[model samples]
Target: MKKNYVVMDGNTAAAYSAYAFTEVAAIYPITPSSPMAEKVDEWSAKGKKNLFGSTVDVIQMQSEAGAAGTCHGSLQAGALTTTFTSSQGLMLMIPAMYAMGGQFLPSVMHIASRVVTSNHHSIFGDHTDFMTCRMTGYAMLMSSCPQEAMDLAAVAHLSAISGRYAFMHCFDGFRTSHEMQRIEALDYEDLRGLVDQEALQAFRRQSLNPEHPTNRGNNVNPDIYFQCKEGANVKANSLPDTVQHYMDEINKLTGRDYKLFNYYGAPDAEEVIVVMCSASETVKETVDYLNAQGRKVGMVQIHLYRPFSVSHFAAAIPATCKRIAVLDRNKETGSVGEPVYLDVVTALNQAGRGDIRVVGGRYGLSSKDTTPGQIVAVYDNLEKDEPKNNFTIGINDDVTFTSLDYKEIELPHPGQISCKLWGLGGDGTVGANKNAISTIGFVGGKYAQAYFSYDTMKSGGLTQSHLRFGDEPIRSTYLVSSADFVACHAPTYVSKYDLTEDLKEGGTFLLNCPWT
Candidate 1:
């Protein structure tokens, strides 16, 4: 089957989907998520039309709060409005989020999930930023990678329109937001067919118009305030089905199956790990490796995080599973467990499956690498008589001794070629490799992925570019530990760092030197 494939990063994928449905996009610049707003702004300037047959109205606001305010007002005025933000920007949008939810407005906020700055500032990927808005009444949906970012964004917006509730479409910042991959692009015509025209007409009819002159946002007495809040219960309860309906529509169009919770690995697995976002990709790889070696291990990848569907989650879990490990990307101080972990335990209890021994662990904070080795450790921890709760992985926590011991395990892809390039952050190596991967993926008709890592001082700091090409989808989320090819674009980098340490035994190493 032919697919209109395009090479893009998570931010671009999100921008493309949001642009298809949005009539107005309120914009504010923030790292990772900024590219999404930039793309929408660029497209709007170029007169790109949405499904409504008109170019989107791109409005740049002074602050994230103002941007969110713009989206709320536009949505109230009967426009399909959206905004892109992350980290502190999401924090500033809390007030607007409450209003959107209370009014049951169909607004989709695209977020490149980032670490929330506390003691120090970090512009990296994690669930810290997205977790803060859990109680704001907006339904949360997570995308595991660039492709899902595009697909799930459509689900978020489509479901929001039909369900009359706001949706937060989130993907990991930097890891996904900056990482480029080849994905099947969605056409506006395909999207237009899936839209709920009746629901949209209803929304417009309910809009604040001079002809209608409807009163809203009126102060309510305490007598009926709680009861009034309960008015949204029916919509909230039906949201999971609403989202699933859109996801099925997307699957019919894209030829990819999606669910509220996607289960993978052994059907009768005794041990399982539950995770969300990009880490799910790495865990899937580990599950395949372990399952191949006769381990009864599996994984439950979450797509719809908000309106957490207990029935769907319970159905996704194998009945044979005896032990479960839950990994969350964010850390919550003084809490018994992180958000996802708490939700999983509650779902299990509600499903009357509380006999399963469950443990929660934290991993991949601030875009920390979550490798297969660490995933193996989590599975190993579940094998213990009493698995450790509130444990951490991918770090040696000697102070608290809460980290599990892990053995390095390498899973090789037979057809994929991995390449690594070392260069300065501002140098053209990253951009060159990005182009190279896009050419290979699109022009050459091959699956490809490219990810770049740099330090805090980005301009002059060391940068490592990881590129992969294969006949099948590339699931390696972590840095290239053993590359088939290695290149050093900087002359002096040979002496400064062990650049060839990760190169394969028979890999070719290219170095730029004046003498050579």
Candidate 2:
């Protein structure tokens, strides 16, 4: 029987799953992602045994480099090892990560995707950390939600052990990590059955054994060095198929579909948005809203980031998609375009679809708010046929401006049971919504969705939560344009902006304020 549970945030769910499967866990705490490590420590302290039927050995190191070293050592000893980190901590592990891949070590790293600080320090969600690891030969997979996070974490582990390649499983930090939801808890027995027993036995047998008396890690001369490197490359290239096979099996069992590049929306839509990570959810919602209004729009969510399956991406995107907006969280300073955007344009050109107009934009860096209003702006630009080459969203660009003029448009439907909340930065409004979503996940016959938006300037910046619960999976993207219920935590914001612009007639509005 399937079991269901509530989780407060993405970090907690990731920690729970890590503790369930990991035999050895090495960690170095960093903001946004620190809670993941903290949860694992708490579980270990309580003597919770993992699925391997052994107590998890937790290692806290001085720095990210030390944690990576510990992970490499543990994996070499034939133990299933895992680690959690973000930002500079992830960058610190790159050197060891390259070596681990070269040695074909089966290990997994859960990254709460965060921004790589520049100019000033920011401890928020972005893909800069994970993007830096792309060249290290690790297989990268991104999860859009907590449910996918749990399921794909298992898939990453199973594939790593079977394929002998390290796996980097990431989701947006704070956005997905700190956001709460209810998802069906995975069965450990089913996971155990998925492991390749014979391959695992072979790995144990190949460990340094006195009986076998084999010489390993021999330094090679130039004569065979190139040949050895090429052999390793060939083996690494074959891992994507291996990873996909396991994903298909998991989907069959769970009734959830997954692929290297998953397409959502009309198969023959004329316009599409290509994106990765948690933001894809918001895009999907927007696509649905536009499609319902008779606008032919669709989305392609990239799940596999590292391998960059060009053929798969081209196939998933419809040829009729003339206007493409590739939104990236990370920016490449002084470059022609952002990484993912560049890849998409290249894929389309290589596929002989150069007629498609591709525009790139940077949004939500350092966890800056990306709301449906901003997404609708992208579509509005497409409709006007005035697509900007390099655009930035969620900001007012007075100098060197490349932003499209966006007016707030009300959604036709207030949506089914739309719930909005206003809370202070640390007052736990975001945390409370996560708990509520987890509760809804436990209740049968309801599909729950949540979106959060925060201001760029930290102090006094607004934070709002848009949530919806209904009988069917909520496909409306963008944001709660027509909100039935609005909660205002900072009563002062109502004086600054039109908080009730999208509030439907006869809708409920809750304000958390003093009786003044």
Query: lDDT of each structure?
Result: 0.93, 0.80
lDDT of 2 by residue, 380-442 (tens): 676666778789888888998967666665444433678777766666787677667656755
TM-score of each: 0.99, 0.87
Give the Cα-based TM-score of candidate 1 against the true structure.
0.99
Off by over 4 Å in 1: none
Displacement of residue 78 (Cα, Å) in model 1 is 0.8
- Give the Å error, residue 510, model 1: 1.1
Q: Tens digit of lDDT per residue, candidate 1, span 308-376?
A: 999999999999999999999999998989999999999999999999998999999999999999999
Candidate 1 lDDT (Cα, whole model)? 0.93
